[model samples]
Structure formats: C-alpha cells, structure tokens
Target chain A: MTISEIVKDILSKAEIKNIFFVACGGSRAACWPAKFFLETEAKHMATTLFTSNEFVHATPVSCNDHSIVVACSLRGTPETVEALRVGRERGAYTVAFTGDPAFLGDPDYALARAGKYMVPYRNSDKLSCLEGNSVKLFQFAVELLHQAEGYSGYQDVQKGLTVLDDVIAAARQKAGPLAQKFVNAYERKDTIYVIGSGPSFGTAYAFSICSLMEISWIHSPTVHAGEYFHGPFETTGPDLPVLLLKNEGATRALDERADRFLAQYDGGHQVLDAQELCMDAIPEKVRGYFNGFVLGSVLSDYLNLLGKARRHDRSVRRYMWQVAY
Target chain B: MTISEIVKDILSKAEIKNIFFVACGGSRAACWPAKFFLETEAKHMATTLFTSNEFVHATPVSCNDHSIVVACSLRGTPETVEALRVGRERGAYTVAFTGDPAFLGDPDYALARAGKYMVPYRNSDKLSCLEGNSVKLFQFAVELLHQAEGYSGYQDVQKGLTVLDDVIAAARQKAGPLAQKFVNAYERKDTIYVIGSGPSFGTAYAFSICSLMEISWIHSPTVHAGEYFHGPFETTGPDLPVLLLKNEGATRALDERADRFLAQYDGGHQVLDAQELCMDAIPEKVRGYFNGFVLGSVLSDYLNLLGKARRHDRSVRRYMWQVAY
Candidate 1:
C-alpha cells in the first residue's frame, strides 16, 4: 500500500486519543508547525511534542494504545529509532518520515507507515526543501486529523496551501532586495536576534537554527516577541541586529509592540511582516493559518542572500555528517 | 496563611488533571525547571507550558476545571495577567508567583493563591536573586504535586533541596576562578552557544537570556544538547565558543556526547559538569532532582564574572523599564 493509504488505515483502525511529535533538533523544530495546526485547527486532539532523547528517558503517561507517535528524522538517527521503539512498546502506533528509507533496516516493530522523500541539497540549498517538508508534515497532520476526528478546517488549510504557492513566489521577489540589503549590512555582524510571535515563532526558531546558525554558520537566537520584553529586550541597543517577523494573527499586537520598542531604541532592526505580503489569493479568514508558510518563504530568501553574501556553502559542515556523534 | 500553606491548601482542593505553566521571557524560562520536575516526578499529571502571549491567544483545550495554571511574572506584565484571567475563565485553578503583591491589584477572580516574594535586586544584581525565585517556584511545584497527587518523590526532593543550599554555596566558590577565566576569555567574543539537556536545559536557557544577553549584553543562544547534533552542530568549529552544562541525570549522556564532539573539534568550549561539583551531600537517588539548581548556581557565578569583566551593570537597561512595549 502507498504511504498515505497506510496512514489512513492506521488512523481508521487505531483509537488515537493523543498525538506525539517525537524527534530531535531540526526535526523537532519541524514538528512545531504541525503542532500549531493541531492546537489551532483541531483542539479536541491532545498533541505533545518531545525531543527524542527526553521522550525515551521519561515517556509520557498518555503514551498508550490509544496514542499515535509521529516522528521525522532526515538521517534516521538512532535516538529517533529508539523513541519509536519505546512508543511501540507502550502500544502506541508509530510512524516515521525520513529522507532515507534504507535507514529503517527492515524494522520489525509496528511502524504503520514510513513516508520517504528524496534528500534535498545540503546547506542553504536545503532551506526551500525544508519548507516543503514542513508543508508535507502539515498536510499529513491535516489528513490524519480530518479522517480521524472530521476536522472541518482541513479544506481551508488545503485552500491556504494552494494560495501559498503563489504567495511564496511573490514573497521571494519582494524579499530579495531586502534580503540582499540585510545580508550586505549584517552578514559579518557577530550575532542576530530573530523575534516572532504566534505561529510564526516556530518559523523564527527554525530559521535561526537551520538558516542562520547551521547554514550560514552565524550566531542567531530566536526569541518570542511577547517574551522579548521580559528580559531579552535588555540585549537590544543601537548596535544589535533584530529581525522581527510580524504575522497577521491574534498575536500581531505583540510583534508590533516589540517593533515599536526596537524603533525607539534605533536598533538595527528589520521587520518582515506577513501582512505586507500580497496574500490576496488566500481568504482573510484563513490567511492566519498559512502565516508560517508565508513567513518561512520570506526568511528563506533572506537566508539565500546571506549565504551568497558570506560566500559560505550552507552544505559544508565541520562536524555534522562528517563525523560520528 | 504562609505561602506553602496556601499552596498546599489550593492543591488539596483543586482537581488538577493537568498543569499549565504560563509566563513570558525570564519568567517563562523559570517555569521550565518546574515543568521538568513535574514531568519527571509526577508523570501521571499532564503538564503543558505556554508563553503568556501564546496562552492567551489560544488557551489549551485541556485547561478546564480539572486543570491548574501556575504563572510567575516579577512585574506581572499585562500579558501574564491576561493569561491568569483566561485560566480563571476556563475554570482552571489559578496561582501566581510574583515579586510584587500589588500586581494582583484587587483580583476579582478565583485565584487560588498569590504567592508573593520579595523582588530581587535590579539588573545583574537580580540574577542571583532570580535563582532564589527559581528555588521558590520548584518548591511550590513539589509541594503542590505532593499534596494534590501524592507524588512519591516529594520527600526525596525536599531532601535534595536541603542539600542543595550547601551545594550552591560550594559551587559559588569553586566556580569563581573558572567563571573569571571564562569571562576574561570570552567576554568580548562574538557569540556563545549554551547547551544543556534534561532539567539543566532551563538553566542554560535562563543563563543565556537573563545573564549573557539581558544582563551582560552578550549574544548567546541556548540549545538543547540533545538537539545540538541535528543542525546547529554544523556551526561548531574552533571559532565558536560553546558552553556545555552537564547534568547528573538521564540526559547527562546527551551533554557528554556533545562535549566529546566539542573536544574533538577543539572549539573554544567549556564544560561545567554538575558531577564535578562536591554534591556528596545529595543522595544518589535524589541528586538528579537538584541538577537544575546546582547547574543554575554555577552558571550564575559565571554570569557574575561576565558582568564584572564587561563592566556592565545588569540593572542598567536601555529600554526594559525605561519605556513601555
């Protein structure tokens, strides 16, 4: 059976009361969009996200026969495999999303589905691909929830994704010059602070790690915009580079407040507002649901410019995949 | 009533099936240690953490009459106040841990308890005091869980804290020289990567934000040690300064693995292992419960040195209290 068919079958048969997104690092980061989807779109389903190592150490009490564990590992790390093993041992249905199917090694455990996708190019080249992976994960979540619990928002999400294709294309063009300017001005800066709120915060986090830190080998920390005032705001000054991702959602006010503070301080700040993007193709009601995708696309353009400006190959790494952990 | 008595009374009456830790920034970071404690010690209780802004935007479905929302805001920001209000509206038992009692401001809702404590010193001076606040929060969590759900590990935790008071003092002395050296060496470095796993991750996050970024105005991002290998590891090289906090628990292996990788690459890396400290006063079975406190105390020492070496007063903020966000 095809992967989607297997997923559907599992959802139909299993009495899934909760969903656990289990992975580590970037993979764990990847789960956030889906988590947001589950929380916002399907509030009835209990969803939890855990780093693989932590999950293996202390499995959640909710992990039982009526639970579904979804894990994604691009490289199929042993930790993730172990987590899946533990999930199965607890009688939870297990599923794996991977870039390399061979890494499964003929697993005997009850893995309902192993969705495989081609590995994307390494480094900054992987940014766009990672976004695609996010979409895949989000779509999978929609399908599972829709089938199991009859989530009504699944169609809206599908429509949003359809509109997002054009939205992303336009965003790339519009963000190019800003991305270039940002890269030129701050490529050599010691550190950058990336701030976002609402659903877009996860995008901020993924961009900081996958694009700025991993791909460009620059130091960037993502802070939640609302939380920025509590303590992190003290780090801001005329010299600090702040990237504020403004999403048109319930949390937009938080970002606007932070942006105003940054403006007052005259910090080297850049605002990437999803509301500024021409998302007319998407209905205003559903636009909030796709803020993650729209913002992610704009940030990817900035990351591309950064990679080009620094003359650093995103794929090249000193430790990752070059040596064993 | 005394704070502990109030806490115990509230816990005994509330039917808390789930617990939510809701706050922003530093306060949010502070909740993590207790969240870890709850997860490890009271596995039967479902615990969810949300940044105040996020929590207010979309309150969790599980947050009902059978839930408890515990929040801490030193200044009682409007966002956190809103979260507490939302929790009350949802019929969840609400508790506030704050530095200012007046912040509650003639509360009309059903706030089970408002545990007020003396506000710490402002600026870098506040860092040490914040550690005390964390101890208070953890203690509240232990007492609440012990009274409400009868967790078996309460006495062990109490024993751990008894020993931790002395351990923290010893750590301060032992960490002084090392902290001074680290400060002198990296005070001016472009960025620092702070990594920790298990319970210590919260300490790493707090130190990075409250100490390095907010207090010292340094660029530091705390990463989960278990997630370090996924993508961020690619950024590690001889140029990047890495600070690894090794805990004495199930997650210690993750930190040691990262340490080994750092050692191999010969990066400017420092390992502050909790096991290295003279924690002989803590029993083997209960030592893990105090890892966050021990590591936090040690890191606080380093923050003190960093503040001194940089000649930056933690209390001197350009925008935090000077301007409204």
Candidate 2:
C-alpha cells in the first residue's frame, strides 16, 4: 500500500487513538512531521519521543499492545530498527517506513511491500538520499492526515510540498544577491546573531552558518529566543545583523514576542520576519518536513550570496572546531 | 540550620518517591545533582523537570500531595517560582532552595525554620556559579547519603568536595604544557566528537563543550557509548576528535565493548574512569563526578592556554537554534 494508505490503516486500528509517533530530531529536518501535524488535526497529541531519548528512571508514555509504534527511518538505521524491536517486545503494534527494506527486518510481507513502494519513489526514482527519503516519509504522514480528516485541504498540503521545492530553488537563486548585500553593507560587522525557537531553531542554526556566515566567511552567533534576556541582550550594536526566523505555527506568538524584543536589539540593523517582510511570496502550509527550514534558507542563502562581493567564501567557515574532551 | 539542614529536614518529612523537582537554567542545574545524590542515598530517584526544556511538550510525570517540589532560585527567577505555585495547586508539598530566602515566600516560616545553621568561617563558602554551586549541592547530597546509609566513607565525600578545586588546580598547573601539546597535536584537528551514556550523558554534554572545550576552546562532540554504531560512525575520521567518556556508574562491560571499536575511529581518544587512576587515592563515591569533567577540563583548559602556539582563536559557544515548526 502507499505510505498514506498505510497511515490511514494505522489510524483506523488506532481506535482513533492508539498511534504513538516517535521522533528524535525536529520534524522540520524531515525525519518525522506527524507529531505536530496530527496533534493539530486531532484531539490527542499522539505522543512523541526522540528515538534515542528513553529513560530507565521511568517512562511517561508506554509502548504496549494498546499502542502503535510508527517509527520513521530514512536509511533503515540500526537504532531505529532496535527501537521498533523494543516496541514490539513491549507488546505494541509496530510499522516501520524506510527506503531500505533489507536494513529493515525481513518480515517478508512488509518487506516486499515497503521495498516495492516507499523506496522506489523516495530513494531511487528521486535519487534522494536518506534526507530526501525522510522528507518523503513526512510527506506520507501529511497525505494521510488529509485522507482521515477529509479536510478538503489535500490540495493545500500538496501545495505545501511544492513550497519546499520552491524554497530550495529560492535559496540557490538568492544566494548570490544576498552575498553581495552583506558584503556592501554588513561586511565588517563584528558579530551577527541568528535567533529562532521551536522547530525553526534548527534551520536557523544550519543556515546562519552554512548559508550566511559560511558563504560570506563572517562570524556570527545563532541564539534561542528569550535567551537574549539572559546575557546576549548586551551584544546588540549598530553594526550587528540579526536574522530572526518568523514563521506561523504553534510558536508564532512567542516568535513574535521574541522578534519584538530582538527588534530593539543591537541598535536596529536588519530584522526580517513574516509580517514585516515579503515572505508571502515564499509559499505556505508548511505541515511537513522542515518546509519552513527550506523557506528560511532562502533568506540566509541570499544574505550570504550578497555578502560575497566583499570577498567572503561560502566554503570557508570558521574552522569547525572538534573539541576533544 | 543552614542550606544543608533545610534540605535534609525537608527530605525527612517528605515521601520523595513521588516528588517532582522543577526549576529553570542554573537553578535546575543546581537541583539535579541533589536528585541524583539524594536518590542514591535515599535509594530512590525523584522525577525532575526543567521549565525551559518543557516549553514545547513536557512529560507529565505522576505526582500528588505526598510529593514535594523543590524550586531553586538565583535572584528569584520567575519560572522556578511559577513552578512552585503550580506544584501547590497540584496538591504537592513544596520547598524552595535559593540564595535569597526572603524572596522564597511571604511569611518564610517553613523556610526560616530550616537551613538555620551557621558557618561563621569566612573561607568556608562554596563557589556558586559556573557549576560551583552545583558541585557543592552534589557533595552535600553525598554527605547526606553517607549519613543515611551509615556509609563509613564520610571523609571520601569530604575529599569529593575538593575534587573540582583539585582538578582546577591541576588544570592550571598543566595550562602551559598541555597548551603546547594540544597546539602541536591538534593544530590540524577540526571537529570534536564526545561520547558517553546513562547518568554520565548529562555530564558528557556538560563537559563536551561547557566543561571541556569551552573551558579550553577545543572543539568536541559527545555521544553515547554505543551510538558510534549509528550515523556518527560515518562522520568519524582523522579530521574529528572523538573523546570517549568512559565511566563506571552504568556498566563496565558496555564501555569495554565500545573500547574494542575505537580502533576504526580516526579522531578517537579515551577518558578512562579516574576511579582507577585515583583508585587507592580517592574514595569510590568520590570518584563519580570529579574524574571525568574536572580532569577533562584540566586537559582541555591546558590546551586552551596553548592557543597562541596553535595560532587559532576560539570563542565560547551558546545555544544557537531549535527545530521550529
């Protein structure tokens, strides 16, 4: 069956509430998106846990016959496999979605089924790596949500999928221009601070360095929201370029408040967000797979591209230090 | 009564099995060691939570009137106080550990009746920041455990109290020599990979950067003992510095097995339990916290002092991002 059909099947057996969505990294990175999406679409939060974050002290949520462990693995990673085995041993129903059925347990029927479908589309057909496969699995979850709710918003979800592609394209296109802008304007700036909260935080981390500072070879700090109050609030100055990730989701309000505080930060250099900028052109309905991370990357990529006029190099990041303890 | 007495009295009257400790940042950091020390001494563990970490979705651990909530404060942080109020509403016993007792509550009767002991000696004060207070609280908990368990190794806990200081002194002493070593040896190293698991994982993270590299400006990455079999295995190379945090609290067998696999890791380094190094010298209970972090810090700090020889400047790191949806 298609991944979406499989999700719908699981939900039907879930008795409207038996599914447990396990997670590790933020869903935006494309590993798992159902946690936030389904919770918003349904009454139950559906339970979430970083695959590796289990505690022997005591488990707040149980994995048993009454539950379904829907684990997502892009490469059929060993840890993910072990986690599924753990759930099964606890008497829980288990279903795994992966691009590598061989790496997955050879449960003949499931193996033949997942290999014939999920892998061909996400791995071979698209030539996507584990990362791309992660995105597709998340896409599958989003598709299933559309079927169960019959929300008539399936098209919106499809558009959201397209938006991810658009964002990636936009990142590449804007890289050069933004690099020049940073060079001509904020080139000599001492320290740039990138800030965001929730799922958007990871995107901010990768882009601030990989896209902007790395591309431009500029030094910067990416911070968590509300952290400015702790001590970094003092780092604001006339020469600082602060990139605030403004996205709409559960954290929109807090993000706005953070933006408000950051606006007054550092003598007011450059502050960009949804309401204050023209990101409407970016696309919407980011219900799956770091869809926003893709969108936000465009801004950082553009900033870095624009900054290169001043001799910044994208490949050159402050030597990524490996601290040996 | 003193801080120690107040904590002890609060424990005597409470059924800690159901207690849940809640606080924020440094305050939460201050209390966790207490839970570990107390649990080991009391032969039980209390449920612990950090407010900021719960901003997304927190595990709703079970608790009731028989439970106690110990809120810690440094300048009466808002979240810690708020958590205490929440606990009271939930029918849980409440306590507050703070630098300023006046801000703990209105009448301060319960607060004042406890922790009243005096230490008039001017030099008797324990340091309160940068994990100083954390160490003091932990050592005191060890002392409390010794008293409760009738452990004859009270002096060992006493020695444990000074381990950090001793490590610090050692760190300072080798600052010159190790700096030169790290400068010459790691001049080409780029990334740091830190690895440890179980209770030590927290400390592994603490030292991975804050206690290790941050103290010395080295780059490090920490992982669980077995996690090396996952994606990190692919990332391991000569360009990285993999610091294995070997400890005894969990299981020596698992650690030994991990040691067998280190030959493939190009950036591999080992931090054997200091219990063996200082076995006859220090007490068993005292060996837990002192050997890894402090000694690692000493080593890393020594490396930092050699920054000039390496010709590379390092900056302390801050929380850069989170996954935003």
Candidate 3:
C-alpha cells in the first residue's frame, strides 16, 4: 500500500490523539521533520520524537491505545524493534519501518515483525536520504494530518512530492563544487560544528551524526541555529570549522543571525543556504517545507566529498555492529 | 501567592491541554526537568520546551487559550520577553519568571511585565540554581499536576522539597574534592563533552552551556547519554575530557552503558553519579526525580573550581550583554 493508504488504515482503527516517532541514530533524526510538521500544521493532535530506547525505558503514562507509535530503523535496529514491542504491549497501534521485507527472517527483522503494521523502505546506503525514511515519515505525517483535519496544504505537499526528485537532482548537481570547496578548506579540522534550525535541523543532525562522526570518524557536533548564541557561539574561533545550514522557513532569521556572526568573528565558516536550492518546482507557499529535503540532498554530496578527501568511506565504523553494548 | 496557588489560578482560568516552556540558554535547560516531569507524570496534558526565539518565530498552532506558556529569563532576556508577548497574543495563559521585582523598571524587566502572570524569582547570581528558576519551574509542574489530577506523588514531592536544601548542602560539601580533582586533571583540555540522560541531562546541559562555555570560554558540548552510541562515541579518545552525570532513574542504564564505554576507551573521564549524592535525604521512590537538582548542586562546585583553576571568571563575557545580536 502507499504511505497515505497505510496512514488511512491506521487512523481508521482507532482515534489517535497523539503520535510518537521513535527511532535511533539517523533514523531518529529522520523523525524530526515529521514532528516539526505535526507541531506546526496540526492543531488537534500532539506529536513527539523520541530515541528508540528512551521510548521503551520511559514509555509515557499516556501511551495507551490512544497513541500511534511510528518507529523506523534502516535494518531493524534492535532498540527500535524493542520500542515497537513496548508500544504494541501498551495497546497502541504500532507502525514499523525497516529494510526490505525479504530480510524478515533475520533476528532483528523477525522481532520487529511483531509490530501491528510494518512498512519497508529503501536503505539510505542504496538511495539518498531524500528517497528514504525522511521523506516517507514526512509523507506519513502529511497524510495523517490530511485525513485528520483536511489540511489545506495537502495538495501542495502532493505537488511538492511530485517534483522533489527533480529538485534534489538539481540541488545535488549544483552542490558538487561547493562540497569540493568545503572539503579542501576544512578537511583537516579536528572538529566541525554544524548549525541549522527548524526543519533543516534534522538534516544537519544526520550529517553530524551519521556522516561526519559515524562514517568519517570526525568530531562533528550539531548546534541548533537558535541555540548557537546560547552557548555554542563561545566555541567560535578563527580556526573553528563551522557549517551553517540556512532554512527558508519562519526560523530563517535565527540562521541568518548566526550567519552574520560567523561572517564577523569566523569568516572561514561555510553555509549551505536552502534558499539557494532549486525549489522553484514546488509551490512558493510550500517551498519552505521542503528545505530539509533540499538540504539533505546537498549534504550527501558534501559528505561524500569529505569522506573521499579524508580517505574515509561511509561504510567505515569502529564500534557500531563490531561491538556489543 | 505560593507556586501552587498560582498554578491553581492558572488552571481555573481555562482547560490547559498543553504547556510550553520557553526560554534560552540556561533558562531553557532549566525547563527540561519540568517538561520531563509533565511528559512522564501527567497523563492528560502535553508539554514542549522551546528556545525563546524559536517560540516566538514558530509558535505552535496548538498554542491558544487552552495552552499554558511558561517563560523564564533571569533579568528578562529580550527574546524570552518576545516569546511571552507571542504567547499572550495567542491567548495562551502566559507565566513569566524573571529577576527581582525591584528591577521591574529596567527596560528588560519592564517589557516582560506584559505576561499575564509575572513571577519574580531570585537570580542565580545571588542564589543557587537549586533556589532559582530550576526549582521554581519544577514546582510549577508539580503543583500543576497536583491540581489537575491529584498526583499521588505530590506528598513525596513536597517531602523531597523539604529536605532538598540540606541534601544540596551536603552534596556541595562532598563534591569539593571531586571538583578539585576534575579541575586538576582536565583544566587544560580544550573541549569537554558532558553526558547525561533523563532529568540529569538538564543539569549536564546547564553545566555545558551556562558554566563551561559561557562562563569559562571552554568548548564544551552536551551529548545525551542515550545518543552517545549513535555517533558521538567516535570522538572518544584518551585525551578527550568527558564528564558523565549519571541519573538514578529508569534511563540510568543508558548512562551506565556510556560510562562503561568511556571507562574502556577513555579511562580519565569523570563521572558525577547522582546516586552517590546525599539523595538518602529524600524518599527512594522520588530520589530519581531529584537527580537533576542533586547533580545541579554538585556541578556548581565543579564549575567554580574549574573557573578558578583556569583564571576565568564566571561573569566574564565577550558579547552576551556587551553587543547586540
């Protein structure tokens, strides 16, 4: 079934007053856009994003049958699977997104099968994040909102989806030289700080955690654009490598403020403004909503080039999967 | 009026379906304990914590007459005051916590008077964080839960509060040696990653942002204990200074996992376990609830010693109030 159809099926089962997006690592970061979407667009339904194990460890007192828990893990992360079980035990309608159903017999996938509904998606390694859980989870949120309240932006979102691939392609093509320039300039820095706000933060988080630290073994940390002035700004120095992802949404001002400061105090900082992405294909009113998608596409190119420059591969990891907790 | 009385008055004004804790920097970290309290303890209400500026820029569509907005700033931060105005404009029951009432004539505190319920509290500079917005905000959450649904732990919370000062004093005295040891070992490090989970995270965040970075100009980033494995663990090296604040709550296991890993990879990392604090003064059932408070008290000693060791004054700031954003 299509994502919207699945959302419809889940909503028809019971009244979902709240939605919980549970995952870990990049998968957890992927849920933020949906959480942001629900927070800004849905007036009646409450939403939360939780790390998978935290969801199981402190299952909310309100997580009963009235809750809808959506969990994602690329290849059935054990904690995420356990979270699905915890949600199911709470009598909440549980939806699990994982790798291909062909791997259902694997121990991780086998346990995740216990969720009420399971949806398989393309792995990020094989496809860009734009085509992976980020977009799918957001589609779930959009559909849920549309079915629940007849969201006026539903049509615009559908139209946006129709042209997202072209927009991402154009963005990736345009970002190649920028990514090369960033790698040449900041490849040797021990730590790189990424900044983003609003929906663009999820993409920033993915780059920091999944690409920079996990894959390239770089010390990269994400600082929310809004929160930069709070404390992270103190870390700014001429030698610091700062990457700012500017959003085109309401929180753009926060990003712009950070950009201005970076220019003054740390002129070497890099910024990838979503406003410069090829978003003309989407409706002008809904273009802001696609900032994450646009930025996520460009970030992939940046990460790929950085990995190559550092003689690191995206598949390299020291402890993940190699070590048991 | 007492905090409980204020909460009661707010509740009587309208049916509050959700609460938003709006602040920036340390104040934003202060709200997490209350947000966590409501998320885990309250069954009928939703809670969200937002950076003050973001709260003003992207105010949730759900924020209305049925929403309760609690904003905090030691002396009326501009963005926080703007957030209070936004909440008031949305017809949210706005509560503002600021500096002493005598400063109400100051421009900062003057504009903050626009909040529907202005609450003046002792600034952190004069008192401990335990006696400042941290405790006050959590009290608001506790009283809110008590009045809304007669929380069974209300008596325990009150009991906890009665002995909190004594517990903090004893913990502070005991922490002096540990703080000195940490300062002597890690004072030269350029960056320190503070780790914590559950309520303890708020204290860790405050230490990282308000103390280490803002005060000492040290590069410190807070890594959520549960999220450390996701990516940040890659940054673990023998030379890296890591401070882990262990919670005594359900999420303690997450912190323990990080502690175990840090022990193997970076044996010099310091840990301030809340369980070892003078928490015996409180009931065991509610002891975990006070982990943030307990650790917060101990952290003051750590920060003070670190500041003296580095010859950096906590009041020193390059831009905070010296320049415009």
Candidate 4:
C-alpha cells in the first residue's frame, strides 16, 4: 500500500483526538508547515509541535492511544527514533517521514509496528530545497483531514497541492535576482533579524536557523512580527540587517506594522511579501494555506545564494552528525 | 478577594478541558514559565501558550467554554485586551494579570466582566525585574492546580512560594558580581546567543528580548538547548558570545550537552546554574519548581548591569510607550 493508504487505514482504526508533530533540529523545523496546515484545517483536533528531546522528557498526558504522533527525521537520529518509540509505547499511532528508511535500521521491523514512508528526495545531504519533504507532510495532513469525518476544505487543499509546482516556479523566478542582491549586501553582516507573522513565522524561523545559522554560519534570529514591537524593535539601528516576510492573511497587518517601523530606521531592511509573487494557480480562498510554502521557497533560494557567496557548503557540519551529545 | 481566592473561585465555576496562556512579546514570554509549570505538575490539563494576535486570528476550536484563557501584559496592550475579550465572548473563563488595574482602561467595565487582578509591583517602567509578574503567574497556576481536585504537590509549591524571598536574595548575591563581569566583557559584542531548556527556556527568551534587546539594545537570540546542536551550534566560534542557563530538572542534561560543545570553542561563554546558587530556603524536592524564577532573577540582574554599563535606561524606548504600532 502507498503511504497515504497506510495512514488512512491507521486513522480508520484509531479514535485519535490529538496530533503531535515531533522531531529535532531541521527535522522539527520541517514539521512547522504541516503544523500550520493542521491548525488551519483541523482546528478541532488539538495539535502540537515539540522538539524530540523535550517531548520525551515532558510527554504530555494527551499522548495516549487516542493520539497520533507524526515525526520526521532525515537520518533517523537516535533522539528522534527514541521519541517515536516512546510515542508507540504510549499507544499513539506513530508515523515517520524520513529520507532514508534504512538509516534507522530494521525498517521492516519498525514499519510493521508503526506507519513509515520515505521522503522522495535523493540528495539528502543538501540543506536547501525542503519542498519535497514539505509537500509530502502537507499531503499527509490533508489526507488525514479528508479521512476524518468533520474536517472541511481538504478537497480545496488537495487541488491546490496538484498545482504547487507552478507556484514554486513563479516564486523562484521572482526571488532569484533579489536573492543575489540580498546575499551580496548582507553576507558579511555580523547579525540579522528575520521577522514574520502567522504561517510565515515558521518559514522565517526555519530560514534563520536551518539556512542562515547552520548553512552560512551567520548570527540570525527570527522574531514574530506581531511581537516585534514589544521588545525586539529596540535592537533596530542603522547597521542592523532586518528581513521581513509579509504573508497575505489576516495577520498581514502585523507584518505591515513591522514594515512601517523598520522604514523609520536607516537600516539594511528587506521585505519579501507573498503578494508580490504571481501565485495564479492557487485559488484566492486557499492561497493563505500555501503562505508557508511560497515564502519558504523564496527564502530557500535566498539562502542558497548566501551559501554560494559565503563559500559555505550547506551539508557541512561541525558537530551535528559528527559528535555524540 | 485576594488574587488566589479569586482564581480558586473562577476555577470552581469553569469546566475547563484545556488552557491557553496568551499575550504578546514580553508578556508572551512571561506566560511560558507558568506553561512549563502546568506541564510539569498538571499533565492531565492540556495547555498551550500563544501570541495574542495569533490567538485572535486563528482561534483554536478547543478554545470554547471548556477552555480557560490566562493572559498578562504590564500595561495591558491592545492586542492582549482584544484576546481577553474574544476569550470571554467565546465563553472561556478569562483572567488578566497586569501591573495596573486601570491599565486596560475602565477597571469596572473590564475586570467586572473578566476576572482581573493587579500584580504586586510598582515602577512598572523598570524592565529589569519581572519577579512580580512571574510570582503572580506561578502563584495563580499553583492555586488553580491545587483547586483542580486531583493534582498533587500544590502544598509544596505554596510552601516554596512563601520562602521565595530567600531564593531571590541568594540568587542576586551570587549574580551581582558575575553580572558586572559578564556585562563588562560582552556589552560591546555585536551579538550573543542565550541558551536554555525546559523551564529556563522562557527566562532565556525573556532576558534576551526584554532586557538585552529592549533595554541594552543588544542583539541576542534565545536558543533551546535541546535543539541547539541541530543548527545554531554551527555559528559558534572563539569570538561568539554564548550564555547558558542550566536548570535543575530533567532537561538539565540538554543544557550540559550545549556547555560541553561550547567548551571546545574559546567563545565568551558563561553558565548560570541554578544549583550553583545557595537556596537554603527552597526544599530540594521543590527546587525544580523554582528553576525559572531563580535563573530569570540572576539573568535580570545581569541585564540590569548591562544596561548600566551601556548607559541605556530600561524605561526609555523609541516606540513601545512613546508611539503606537
């Protein structure tokens, strides 16, 4: 059976009430898009995203037989695998998304016990272009909602996913030259502040950590636009590197407010608004659903340019895969 | 009625299944400690912390009459006030924690409608000490848990709160000279990474934003220790300034792991361990409960020193109080 069929079969048997997206590092970051999808489409289902270690230590009472735990790890790190095992022990319907099914070893043994699928990507070493992982996760989420009884709008979401390639192409075309310009101007900056709101907040966070800090070795922190004014705005100055991502949603006003604030400061500030991209394929009502994907795609292109400019290899790591904690 | 009595009364009336601790910026960071406490002591209660704007826009389906919304804002900002109003409208029991009863305007009109109480503190402008707000929030959480009928160990929590003054004094005594030294070394640095896990994560976040960024105009981002090696550790070097807060809890191992990684680099790294401070008044069994408070107090002292060294007044802000977003 295909991954979707397996998930459907599992869901059909379980009386799941809560869902947890669990992983560590970039794996955890990759879960954010799916998290946003669940929040938007399946709000009735209590959903949460937790780092693998934290989840293991502070295992919520909700993580029982009535819960579904969806986790992803590119290399199937020990911590993440342990978390999935713990979830299974607690009687949760465990689902794993991974690039290398064999990386965890005893794949057949694990699959027999919990649902597992391999992410359709060959170059697992590269940090850029998480579109494949994100696509699979979002598809799984939409399928889960569709299989569930009360959830609405999954049909629109499935339709949108079918045409996401066109959206990605358009976002890349607009982001290419701008990414080069941004990379050239701020490649040497000592620090940067990346701001976003709503769905784009996860993209901002992932880009700052997975791309800027990990790939380019830059000091970048992602701040929520809605909360930017409360404290972080004080760090703004003429020399600060600020990157703002504006999404087309009800939370757009919050990003606009941050933009207005940054306009007063004579700093190196850039705003990547989702409305600027030509997402003609996605329906107007469902465009909000793809904000994270579109913004993340554009930011991923910018990060690729940054890696090229800084002479940093996206796959190179000092301690992540090298040393044991 | 006293705040504790009012909270107990409110708890008695509500059939809450889940709880949301909502606010924006520093206020949101403030809710995290209480959120952690709830997770530790009352695992049966589903709890979450969200930014006020996000809560307003993507109001969760679980946020109905079966939910309790607890929020805090020093001045009761517009976003927070709106969130509280929305919670009340949704029939969720709403509680507000603020330094001033009139800060939200028309105490009789607002508090009379939603349960509101003033945090015991004067000089609300001072950003250095958030003890009053933290104390009130944890106290409210403990009292709520105590009145919930099934939760255990509320008596120990209450006893610890009674002797918190001793903990605060001891933490300050140890933090004062160390704070001066840390500020003198890193006050001029371009950026810093504040790392913590578990209960200390909120303090790391709040100190980096509320004190370092807002008051001293420093660039710092709080990184969760469990997730630190996954990405941000790649940015570490001899010159990088890293501050780690070690809590005496199940998550302390995560912080120790980060400390070991930082040791390989000659970065201006510092660790403020809660166990290092002499807290004779706090019982050994309950020391974990006050880890957030102890670490936050010490870090706040360091921020105060940094503000003094940098000649930055904590109350002075370009936009927060002076202008609107």
Best candidate, lDDT-wise? 3
lDDT, candidate 2, B240-298, per-residue tens:
45556555543343355456556544534544343333333345654554434444444
Reference-based TM-score of each model: 0.87, 0.54, 0.96, 0.91
> What are the DockQ scores of the candidates, in order?
0.51, 0.06, 0.70, 0.57
Estimate the lDDT of model 4: 0.74
| Top DockQ hit | 3
Q: Which portions of model 3 miss their true places by more than 4 Å?
A: A101-108, A124-130, B102-108, B125-130
Q: lDDT tens digits, residues B1-325, model 1?
A: 5447866666667656777888877777777778877766663466777888788876666687777788777666677778888888888777776653333222332222332222221223234433455776777778777876677777777677766767778877787777877787688885788999888888888888877777777778889887887777877877478888888877888888889888887567887888888777877775776777777767777876777777777677766667667
Fraction of native contacts under 8 Å reproduced by each candidate: 0.64, 0.00, 0.61, 0.61
Clashes of 2: 50
A1-325, model 1: which lDDT tens digit per residue? 4445656777677766777888876677767778877765553456778888878876766688877788777656778878887888888877776553333222332222332211221223233433444666776777877887787666776777766767878877787777887887788885788899877877888888888777777778889887787777887778578889998877788888888988888567988888878777777665676778778877877876777778887677766667778
Error of 3 at B285 (Å): 2.3
lDDT of 1 at A131: 42
- Candidate 3 clash pair list: none
Per-residue CA lDDT of candidate 3, range B40-82, in tens? 8888898889998888888898999999999988777788889
**Candidate 4 residue-wise lDDT, A69-129, digit = tens:** 8877665666677778888889888887765444433344432244343333222223333
Which consecutive 10 residues in model 1 chain A have the weakest lDDT in total?
Answer: A115-124
TM-score of 1: 0.87
Give the candidates in order of TM-score, highest first. Answer: 3, 4, 1, 2
Cα misplacement distance, residue A105 of candidate 3 (Å): 11
